[model samples]
Target: MLFIKRFLDQVDEKPHLSAVADQLREITYEQLCSRARRAARVIAKISSEVMIGVAVNKSADYVVSVLAVHLLGRTVVPLDSHCPISRLKQMITSVDLSLCLVSRCQEDKLTDMLQASIRLIYIEDAIGEEDANDNAESTRSVEEEAPAYVVFTSGTTGKPKPVLMPYRALNTLIDGMAKATEPRGTTLLYASQGFDVSFQEIYATLCYGDRLLIVTDAQKKDLYALTEQLSKERVTRLFLPTSMLIPFVTFSLYEGVTLFDLSEVIVAGEQLKVTPIVRRWFKSHSRCRLINHYGPSETHVVMTCQLDNEPDDWPDLPPIGQLIAGSDAWLLDERLQPVATGCSGQLYISGRSLALGYYGMPELTSKSFITHPLTQERMYNTGDICVLNERAQYEYKGRHDRQYKVRGYRVELREVEVAVLASGLVDDCLVVASQLGLTTSLILYFTAPERGQDFSLSLHSHLAATLPEYMLPSFYRGIADIPLNQNGKIDTAKLPQVGGVRPRLSSNYVEPQGQLETLVCELAAECFGLDRIGANDNFMEAGANSFTLISMLAELRHVLGHSFRQTDLFEFPTPRLLCGNVQRSKEAPESKNSIASDTKRKLRSAAIHNTHGRMRGRHA
Candidate 1:
């Protein structure tokens, strides 16, 4: 509430300042506050101090709706407009949400999908229907102890538990960010609406009285679109998932640009690793300033490790450096006793940045959230394995639990294992997890009665229904038996590695012949961090998302000299199919050339110019 009050103060003082802008339009602080006031009139009619779902995408409407909820002293539950209908229904049911601010375009879908009892207020129409002068403010005081927001997890562990983040904690994060970065110019609101990072984006920008550039849903993952928007918006502050930072920078470099000339790139949402390429890139681009962070959703950010100064002596995974001010952390062993410096132990964070525990999970909360021995401040066991080096800097080891991050989403190995077992296909399964460079992947190793290409295909199809793409295993390998040590426990060391299986993605095997075909195969292997991937392997089946494709496409453009659209990969995922398409696309113009070479070259130049013009127009 304090943060909202501060943001509102900015809205009142700097009425003409740029508040938020998207592809279609921009809004001043006055317009944004006015719209939020109008929205508050409608929202207050529902119920005060109740949870309200804002089922919208990355837009000004979402910003307005969240503010409206805060203005009414209600909690905002962000339901991504593009989320699966099943996930949406589950969240709505779990939270007992009866009212949702739905975009006009998404009304029919919500009406059809949701129960008749639940009401969907069309935010687009509601924004303008009520007068800004209406006195519909709730009587809730700013001193009220209520949650600011509840961000839902990816449900990879089991079900998505809502992480209750209080207003004071939220306020503290933004206040800290303002001091940490002294943010100026526009900040990009680029993450998913439901993500906790988006919380940082919205509040950090507005609370600090800075501008926010909202990227459209379509432009979110498309590197070409994002780069253009970044350059056009002149974004000076940006935060990206570790998964996306490298690839985006790679794409920007290929286009002869850094992500931004004067931007502070804070890479979080997952473990930040400094590869040789990332190290070299940061050093070469002197203007690039980066703040690498590591923490769980429960703890917003525990440390700020400077990434721009990645020394040649940097390890594969650098230490998640010094703690944030006012944060007291402990490296504890299993007994919760302090471990010696330079010894690996689970990290327990006691700080203002800790969340107010998981919503509706008191037992679980009591277990993880404990009182500090030295300081009685409520502390959270991060379940993250870390170590305090002799230099007094904390370094990340890995997660103590089986949990891992997939594209910035928290995923538990047990969750995937449970889903795999529920299929009634495999009795015993061991998910072999690995990370290559910055990409994290899983390989399902199971013991089946009969093993062949059909086994993997069936399991893949079964998983597609229950698990999200990021949670699915990239490779399916059948083992003769579950490896066990003398203690009768599964020995990961004894299990067969992925490449040794000598299995094709599908029954139909197609070997690479040409240079382009071979290049596609290599890209697939590298992108997915696979030791062996056939030309017939589907990228999606191999856990390759758009982020992977962005990096892959950048390389292809450099090597093949053919600029291809991102959509081309979805249809032709296999290397054979993609290679064919690229070849045909390349030869199409030359094969059917009715115009001269000079005219074609001129047309190409004009086309590029027009594209840039359109990109500029979008941000206008």
Candidate 2:
């Protein structure tokens, strides 16, 4: 059955049930259907294009606009509101989008960013109560094989490639999820709008007659806020990126709070590690199960491992588990021949869950989606290296590109990361290879429970006991947290520069000399959750990012009664430098340099406010 048909049936069954909600408002199934119908009529009058862009923020309106596009049998190209104008333009141009749906609040900003050739339709206007009874269903029949939506890749290698998903593929995902997870009261919509996971969060919940709770940016950034919201809302189902699982579970365990109402916690987008803290969390909240789902954007979700057993019995590194319904996977060697049982090989997936291929890039699509040698069937070449264990479950060894040669020794980055995590000293760790002039250096970036604690020596000793000498990281850096991009995956680009002079750890802490310097140190310490911040400590090296910098700037402005530009933090990264600048600024408040600094500060504030507005519209 068509997903749209199923959704409509759900609406008929539960007309007054809450379908989707954000922090500000809630909409019932009946109201959602009405809004979609209204928006569809407006879109039909605007254009006959098959592909429509939905650029609205994550809210009930965003959900309405997407449904309206589906109602008209048009493929949706979900655009991130926070993306740079250049990147958004690339996505729009790549999809050949002629019309985009924008929210009233963001219409002006989008108008300025988007080309004049691309028409912008206000979602508020489109869903207005005019012509309430107009026919919204498309006159043209939408075939099951026709494209349903387009989601772009992360573009780590090059330009982001648009993966076209057809209706049949979406159906496969919905059906598979229904079988894997039991129906619950509510599912948190934690993913960003453009992410493929958002589709699963939005559609899967609505199809199951469950309320979809959209998380706000503020809640998502703060662990306490997120957990409180989850408990208050009685959120039964939750999905998190694998990188976030450890920190989230650790925080929850530290608080000694168990969300007894939560039924399932699904994690994906990276390898799953069932650390001691994670096991304890699940054991305490016995009602909640941890499910590790594995799939690339090319195939929505193909395999899943559910830790239904006792937490103590779970493996440290859980397997990706068995294939989902209607999905088929094969482990093939370099020559495309099937690998022997228990041997590692590249994973290949073939089934209805496969996407239609990259939009407007036939060569790339042909390269990634190839024909199986023995079966002569179309299959996606998943670059993941995996091995079948004794239980017939697939264990994720590592990614094909993540394997590196260090000092003439083969090393899997994941293997090293597992070793660090097993030490139990750090909450999370990322192992990366840094290329120097003539030698490659292994750098380990980690986040520990106590940000002020220096555990480098202990971590090194722990890894040395298990891993070979070559696998050990040459340098260890403790960060405030593992940086995750908007999509909730580890943002490797945001990791600190490896070759630079390392910052002095807490052990070599230096005291502040003056009142101004002391104030700066206190603020830095509070922001980073460190007990003490040295006057000469580097900001970026201490795990300061754009968000943390903005926070510190706000606090500084409050206390100093003077505005400071973000660039000031970049220029004078240390507490000592910042205090010196503050003293100078106070002495010459009206100087020419001060005037110029004021102007730059205003511009920075405006830019930050704009970003904050977009964030407010998204999940917490």
Candidate 3:
């Protein structure tokens, strides 16, 4: 392959350049290539396509082992050392692994997981410091389509899919990235090695001759420390899933923290919901370019991007932009025909990035990577249903199977469910799309907020105001917690069956006397999906927290000619108290125009001038 040889040539040219830095060790380019070549020599003796499983911690040795596999003209299966022992066994069995390369520390654990028949070689013992016996003599180099590695992704079905990639596809991606970004002096933050996105970070950094810095496992869980480290190191490039980014902003982790002249940051893997705090952070650190990246494991690292122009781009649905250099996107309807632009369709991708299909599962591979009607090219069908907007940007519309038609109205259960969780009243939640014979319904499972206050009434009331009656959940159950599947996603199978459960309002409370107070409480109850509003319950913690909702409340207060401060409503959303406060108002109700004008000015000014450092953290 072009890369294996090119990597060696680069090392020869710049031997002293830093290649990998992890925890307390740093490996130079020369050492990397030398070790890789030595390891490759050992790998060449092995039979099969040279697919070897690697089990190493976040260390320089782990990086060398990956490169070594490449040098041997064989694919490398990089396994997470920290994954469940059972998962490791399953992967080894599926890949028919010839050998495993692991550090001395993981030798015992590897032996426990691997079968007696399989070989587990220690890295320190297997690849010694001696120079590799050269392979440039008689052996002919293979072509580009040679397998590089097989990445296993958590499957929706029971088993995980081992997605295979060729050297050409990966090399093509590397070339495209070299063309898109700036220079090789970039320093990257390596978060997780198991995830494909981390691979993207690894290759992108090396190809550009940039420094690759690995974040420790402990640092990964601690956002405050991670952000501090990122700032301290002056890291220029980073790749993080949206789920991780949200909580970082929510907790004000960036407060008072000065960014390390960050040049570029790429966020992907999950839907990005950039909040107000994130927007302010980006504005203050305007030099950094926030890129919204999208793609599945099969399509290499990224397929599309919606570049961030402002910080506000974070909290909304970031558009999955146009296809990359060698890739083509076909948005097809149910009949497999190209749908009209702006119409929702199943997205299919073709070209180099399409994986060599799932490992061993030929049937599944054939089903997903099918031939295109007109082009005659094989394209991988992405189950995600998406709509191409007027800008030709792809706006994701939930999964095709996730859409449930309830009472003649097609509903996106995720949107409604996310709205509920956004209220902050629910600690955790899951929205399940299920069909009982002819009837379609949404089953919601949630855990109440930490204060032990039941939010059943308020959430339903708030949802009613924003959602159509038919779109609402037929059943909402509060559980101590929603169960997780083996792969860590919400497990729909484990959700309790709601067969005979009757619909019931969570709370029934009296209204306050003053008209202003009564209306606000009613509005709160409606917007929050609750049956009744309570005086003592904190509105912010109820998950009804957001700038948009605050804006809406201000609009309503102006329309009713009520003297309601946004924070006052936030502080006292309960009926009786708000009504009393409104009734005893000595100041006249400000004009609707004046109120709206002032609120807009204040929010914009606050956002632009929000220099206060507040430490906050949120889970994605």
Candidate 4:
């Protein structure tokens, strides 16, 4: 509440200053406040404390809608517009939401998914354009414990649970951020709106009378474009999840450039594991301060670990660092008693930054958020196993429930992912323990290297050399990119299931005819460790996974004196068809990027196209 009041005060002082910007245009502080006030008049008519959804999108109007809803003391629900239609419906039903605010870009799909009983107000439509018939609301005292925002996160029982955070928590967070960052500059709101850090970014930007820039959906998918935008805008601060940070840094290094204006880089949503690339980034970049921030959705940001210094300050486990203002961390054993230094315990956070509790789930709320034994203050059980060091700093060990027994020895999947990242070949990796009857298989999913580069074999070799046999994953799947949730965390639910039926090739063969076809055959045969030379050999059956296919294409480009895309393998798996495409690529060097886009076109021309199905031999 204090932060909100102070933010408005700043806005009043600098009414003409640029407040927020998207990809297209910018809005001044005066327009933002005037629209928020008009929208507040409309929102005041709604019943008090009713849940209202603010669709997570990159629009200035969405920001205005959020501030307007807060003015009426109604709880704002940050919904992921990209969530499954069915899940969105279920959430609407659970929360009894009758109204939701959305941007024009998201209106069509959401309206189609939503029931007629629900109302969708376009953000621009909510505010009065000409200031006509304004129904101003009377001033009232705000309650200290009233819920301000409810963020839904995945629970252990496979359900989306909503956590209600009070206004005090947000105010404390904004105050902390105002104190931590520089007094004035632009801050990027690039993470999903549902993410707690996004709230920090929005309010903190306003508190400093600074500019707020929302990253468009297109820029988020492309690292080069995003960096260019950030540099172009001269954004001084950015908060990215660790998953996105590594790739952006890697692409920056590959391009041999550095951002001159960015002053700080804050990474969270995953463990800050030190890698060779991380060391190199620190060594090379001296202007930007690298910070490792840690907090659950329940506690707002609490701890920070500075990573500017290199190897000597880093250990196997990165410290979550010192506590934030008005926050306290305790290391307690299973019995809720203090543990000795260096001993592992469940970390509990007690502070004004705590969320009120889970909405509509009283039992869950009571179970997780409990009273501290000594202080009698409410505390949240983080479910994270942490160890206190001699310096009184807390280090994140892993999740309490992330441990699994493999061959009678405990394995931490975080350790596995950390090791994989430390190898310097992979950027983001996920290790899942898939059950197969009585035994569990540790399956590793990783993103392949950039086009025209090969690293899967080297990654496998590195894992073997580093870890014991029991700790190693049985099946390694290299994907083009790692799937991420709306929160920018790994989407575990979307990972490929293990132990599925493996496709087989039929008993058919078509020998290579053309020179390009023969060369492709040899490359595929050598890359997959197979001796068979046929035009219709099933790539999957020949032990060629996605990672090997990229390498195969890279090798093909080198030998043929032309560039072939990684996607060309999937579109034209048959040697004859792929060879024909390669010859065209050689002839049309100017259209290299478009050469990959012609995948479906080439597939349509083929007599038989198996876009995803296995290519059979002559006989079944």
Candidate 5:
């Protein structure tokens, strides 16, 4: 059955059941249906476009907008409101969007950023209209091959590519997920609307008569608040990116918070590592199970590994497990021939779970999606290297392009990351190869329990014991947190640059001399949770990222009664240099107007700081 019909059946069966909710409000099944119908009527009257864009924040209105588009048999093109205006504009043009639905809070801003030719409809206005008789049943017979939505990739290589998913593909995913696990009772919708995973979170829950809990932007950033909501709302099923699961579990365990209602925890979007903390978390919460899911945006979710065994028996690196129903997997060599059973090869996928090709880019689509030589089936090149184990399960080797050569030796970045994680010296780590003019340098970026603690010497000894010289990283940088993009995967672009003078790991601490230097050092120490910060220590080397630096600057502005821009950090990274600049600024004369202007600037800076805090809550 179509997901829309299934949802309508659910509404008819349980009219008063809680359907969807956010921080502000909660709505029942009947109310959600009514709102979707009203919004659909408004769209029918104003626009005839088939592709409608949803550019609202994470709220009940956002869900309503998506359902409204589906009611009219139109394709949804989700646009992230937090993305830059230029990027949004480019996406709008790329999909040839003529109409977009937005919330009243963002209408003015989007109107200015979007093209004048595009029509914007306010969701509040639609929902506020007089209650009308439902008339969308006729449109419920949407063709299975019709486009359901268009989701864009992160575009690490070049411009973001749009992948068009059909209704058949979505239905297959919903069925597979239902069979994988019986979803029930208040599942959290944590993924961004633009990401394909959001579809599973939204449709899979609603179609199964489960309540959907929408997380607010503020709650997402505050771990304490997020855990409180999870326990208070009795969320039964939760999905988190692999990068966030460790920290979330560790924090809850340390805080003595009990999520008695949570029964299942699903993680995806990266490799899953079974660290000691994870094993301990499962040991404590015996009722809750950990499910590791693996798939790309093109195929919503095709494989899963459910860890229900004893915590002590789990492997450090779990296999991605077998393919779900409605999907077929093929391990092929570079020449497109089937490889040996145990040998590693590029993974190819075909069957009902496959998406319709990339929208309007036939050349790129042909390059990625091709026909099998023997079976003559249309398959998508997953670009992931995999090997079949003795248990008939596929183990993920790194990506095809993730392998790089240094000093005439090939190195798999994932292997180095595994070694770093196994050392247990750091909480999280990411290893990447950096290219400079003609030399390629291996850099390791990591986060630890003590952000300011230097682990260079210990890590060097650990890697030297297990890995070869070429595989060892030349530079190591500690950060407050590993940066994650909107989709919850590691954001390599946000990693701090390693171009400046490398600080000696074993250097003697230099004490602050004057009051200005002392004040700077004290604030730095407090921000990073350290005993004291040396005047000559580099902020970046001392575990400072762009987000933390902005916050530190805002606090400094409030205390010193002087304004400092983010660029100033690049110019004077050390506390001694920063104090020197502050001393010079104090010596200059100030007028009454200048003081008033400074006060206004401080207020503005405070607002920006709050915004940054919200942005920091997003998982990479």
Candidate 6:
């Protein structure tokens, strides 16, 4: 609330400009301030306690509607455009929403749903309805302990649990994030709107007089054009999931031809396992900076870790890293005892970044956020397992609630399962960390198309690039189909168990030849913990990436007595293509100069032309 008046006061100075539908639409500072105030005035006339859903994509109207609700002193729930109508209906009913701010594009799709119980209005209409006299004259004391936004998470109870985040908590997060990333006039891309991180992006950009680029739901799914826009827009900041980052790297946008002059790139949502080639490509592009960010939604946006080292130098699985500016963390044992450095335990996060609690679910909130028995400070039990390293940084081990011990090592079934999914071997996969009595074992369940090629061999090949030997699954099982729970999560309990035998594919493609291929194959076999390697295997679809590929390249280069950059492998991912590229690079040149001779020739040509033009002008 402290930011409200200040944010409005500065609105006329710093406006938000967006490029949409191939046209540059500028939202001036004064316009935004005026719109928010107007929208707020309109909303204030409505019921204050009633929940409202703002269903709009990346637009000025969406921003204004959000601010309007804030001004009206009401909680605004963000519902993404991508969510299904059924889900939206359920959310509306559950939250007891009295009104919905529907975007113009969404008007046709959702017009029928508007009824007597819930009023619906287009964002543009609401903005237009604001009176000229309406201003921030009616200032009130800010609510110190009230919910600002309620972000929902997928729940096992077949419904989403809305996590209520208060203004004070968000202010704490904003302060911490601001201290860590001092973006002065920076432009940050808003990737996830429904997610709490969107708020961070919004506040961060507005607070620092920076620009917030809202990527349309369409643009996010379109990688090729998105890359083009990123370069053209001169966008400097970006934060998204690892899944999204992989394509950005694999496509080689970092090499050149991007719209934006990206200075900082932060990836989160899931674990970051960037390939060596990706890292090397980023390093070469001196203008762009890459960071691995780790956090949970419950902590506002981020609580810990800003990965600042080489992805390869990091652990087999990189450490998640240290606590953030206004947050603290600890690894605790089963009995709530603090674990020593390098010892794994459940992760607990504390400090001002904590949220208010789950909306209308006080018991569940109490269970997760509890008093630190000794310090008596409120701490959030993250339900994640981690280890505090010697550097006092945290290494993500697994989920405490989801994983269990198997032969002394705590096995994260989902980690293995995600690796499997990333391998592109199976359509749906789930690794259950269950036991048959005292003996512990993992059951890998997957489903693929009946006619589609088997991925077992490819899975082994891809896992070699990222996972360690000990973390490998004890058994592989193929189900006719993977059962999905009502909440859309994989139903591991329903997976039928099978014998401990690797399924064989019917493929008959011959393996590629040459010593480099042989060496690559050998390294793949070792990294994957596989007995054999095949030629027809794809690098990424099989889950191989810049990180693991780098490891393979490191070993291969050492044996070959020459260094190969990460770009070479990514350009030529498979053994056959990789060997060809490697051979070509080796035969072409070993020069490590920053600029090529041809580039110098072009620069000299331009300089001579400029000199001649200047001389001609003086004579005239």
Top candidate, metric TM-score:
1
lDDT scores in order: 0.73, 0.76, 0.63, 0.68, 0.75, 0.60
TM-score per prediction, in order, is 0.88, 0.71, 0.66, 0.70, 0.70, 0.66
Of the two candidates 1 and 3, the one with more favorable TM-score, higher being better, is 1
Q: Tens-digit lDDT track for model 3 on 1-620?
A: 26555566566677798887777877788776666666666666664456888787767777778887776667888887655565566677778886877777775765666636467666776568654353233123656787888887644343456888888778777777763545555455555555666667767777666778777766655444666677776678777655445444433332346665577777775555556656776777788777777777778644567455566645466676767788888899878899986788999988888889888989989988999999999898877788887776777776765544443233456666766776777887777756421134566778885545666667777666545444456456778778887888777777776533223333344444544444555445433434444543334333243322333344344334443553665555545555556555634465342335667657644542332111111100
**What ranking emerges by lDDT with the best candidate at the front?**
2, 5, 1, 4, 3, 6
Using lDDT as the measure, the top candidate is: 2
Q: Which ranges of candidate 4 are over 4 A from the true structure? A: 46-49, 115-117, 132-140, 179-183, 308-317, 402-586, 592-620
- Mind sharing the TM-score for model 6? 0.66
TM-score of 3: 0.66
Q: Note the residue pairs that clash in candidate 2.
A: 215-619, 215-620, 216-619, 216-620, 217-620, 220-620
Q: Which lDDT value does model 1 have at 462? A: 83
Better of 3 and 4 by lDDT: 4
Candidate 2 lDDT (Cα, 0 to 1) = 0.76
Question: RMSD in angstroms, candidate 1?
Answer: 6.4
What lDDT does model 6 reach?
Answer: 0.60
lDDT tens digits, residue span 337-403, model 4: 8888778999999988898888788999899898888888889998888988777677887677765
Angstrom error of the Cα, residue 411, model 6: value is 18
RMSD of each candidate relative to the true structure: 6.4, 14.5, 13.1, 13.0, 14.0, 13.0
Ranked by TM-score, the better of candidates 3 and 5 is 5
